[model samples]
Target: MARPIWSGTLSFGLLNIPVSLMSGERRTDISFRMLDARDNTPIRYERVNADSGEEVAWKDIVKAFEYDKGSYVVLEPEDIRSAAPESHDAIEVEAFVQASQIDPRYFEKPYVLVPAKKAEKGYVLLREALSATGRIGIARVVIRTREHLCAVMPHGDALLLLMMRYPQELVDIDEYRIPEGKGADYRITAREQAFSEQLIETMSGDWDPTQYQDEFRERLQQVIRRRMKDKGVVRREDEEPELHENAATNVVDFMSLLQQSIARKRRTPAQASATGSDAPQSDGPAKKAAKKVTAKPAPKASTKAAKAAAEKAAGAASKRASRSDSSPAKPARKAVTKKRGKVA
Candidate 1:
């Protein structure tokens, strides 16, 4: 087994278990190094004293807190450890809260909690209890030298210790401007609303995260590989790609797109019979035809109320048309001629 980054005791009221913490995630991002423009040499960094410009040894370094300008309180390693919270060897559970009550932004990083020797039963018991109650434990833990707010919860086979930020650490959402009042602004119609719903239904599928991969990263790697093969290599193109004059082509009117989507879904059986395949379906051609007629002409705040109004209006119009169709038409009245008095 791989060596654990941390070995500590996980504690609740009267329960305790020896646990090892290991990172839950690994970064796969491509890393880059800075190079000199002329010599193409990799840069080296060094720590130096700002006043004397002399290189400082790592062992000689001491951390300090500046309480005032030009004044600092230097701290030694032993002094710092002594001042830290007393429960350094334990994860002390303070409270348990509903999983839904936690704000997503507060959680920072996660680690897998593995059971140590003789602690297997306790670990499984805690994991099962957390899963059954649908609650997560809020706790304070000291991972290295720094203390952190953490959440202890159940994972598939092991427990997860998720680091969290204090409430004060998060910036208030009110600091930024955002669209308000349930989108009370967009002029959405009933037809559009119905179509959008159908479109959602047609496109809905179970999420499989494995189906997607990083396209940009893959393309970047391709460029890197091509350069490695030949330094002077240039990308070749088959033909000039067409440029669209209308920017609104992609941000299509929601309702029109939705209707097209539904129609496409409904036509699948007939299309399958003709093609003899389950694939090959599209709303692109239909959307292109109706783009000019149904595109959202103005870029403005769109709201939800449009659906209610448009549907009501459409329903009323339909009722009026139905009533007119069933009723008999009235005949036009003939003009009455008045007998004029005899004039000489």
Candidate 2:
């Protein structure tokens, strides 16, 4: 069973909905460890004093604030505990803002807000209200002894609480260099605008997450499985086929390529049907050829005698074709020529 990381009441005005926060997602991936190459042993890290170049005990470490260059004021655990946020079990809603008002970059971790025991009525009410308003709830909540700026928003029939970055945590956007444009008149032709709109229409489609996959992950897992089965890693083929220098320069005509692809697809069924019909007719000639090519006792002969025997065999084949009325006899001469050419 899943456990709730936080349990609190979502409060706004006089409304209070008891909710339990639970982590919604997880990552499963291969992790690597740093190791000593010589002995293949895992390497460990140590906290050290930078100035002294010596290891420091965990107990000796304290949070510090750097007030000046090369100077720091250390604060103890007790000092931080005293300065911690006030403990609050409630999520205090401050305002309702348009969902689009928040920049996605400010969003951080997410948690599912499930209705607490006996709080189903209040939870449904808040979910319906937010859905109707189409606005997200801006709230503050303390989690893990730290106050977090968060947004409570409706997702389907439930609430999704996302931690947001504090204003101070984000760098000012204006600090980065931005491109400047000269004050000049610019115009777009009506034809160009219409063509751009048509191009967008041609590429538009509904978003379907099911059509996408992590192909790299799947391939990596296949490799891992093969390795575990005691198979040595298979190297990829090294041969690179020589490409025609003017292949791209020749430029494939798009319309012709599309027509060719359609034609190939249309021919597939016809090709299959043709093969099915020809199989029976092909069997008779194949059987006759097999019988004629069967192994026979060799006749001893001199070089001249061997040439004479070859001429006799050719004469006999021609005589058999003249006697046979079957259309198969015509192809027999072509097959013999092809076979002799291959052998030579």
Q: TM-score, each model?
A: 0.68, 0.61
The C-alpha stretches of model 1 lying farther than 4 A from their native spots are 66-73, 183-194, 231-252, 261-344
- In candidate 2, stretches whose alpha carbon ends up further than 4 angstroms from where it belongs are 49-55, 168-189, 230-344
TM-score between model 1 and native: 0.68
Instruction: Score each candidate by Cα lDDT.
Output: 0.77, 0.75
Whole-model lDDT for model 2 versus the true structure? 0.75
TM-score of 2: 0.61
- Error (Å) of candidate 2 at residue 218 is 2.8
- Winner by lDDT: 1
Which digits, one per residue and each the tens of the lDDT, describe model 1 over residues 1-344?
66788888999999999998888988877788999979989998899999999999999899999999989999888998887798788999999999999999999999999888889999999999999999999999986778999999998888999999999999999999965653226555666666667678877899999989989889788878888889876676578665453334536666555564576577666677996654323435655756655665432212233444445445555676555533221110100011111111
Give each prediction's root-mean-square deviation over alpha carbons: 20.6, 14.9
- lDDT score at residue 167, model 2, on the 0-100 scale: 81
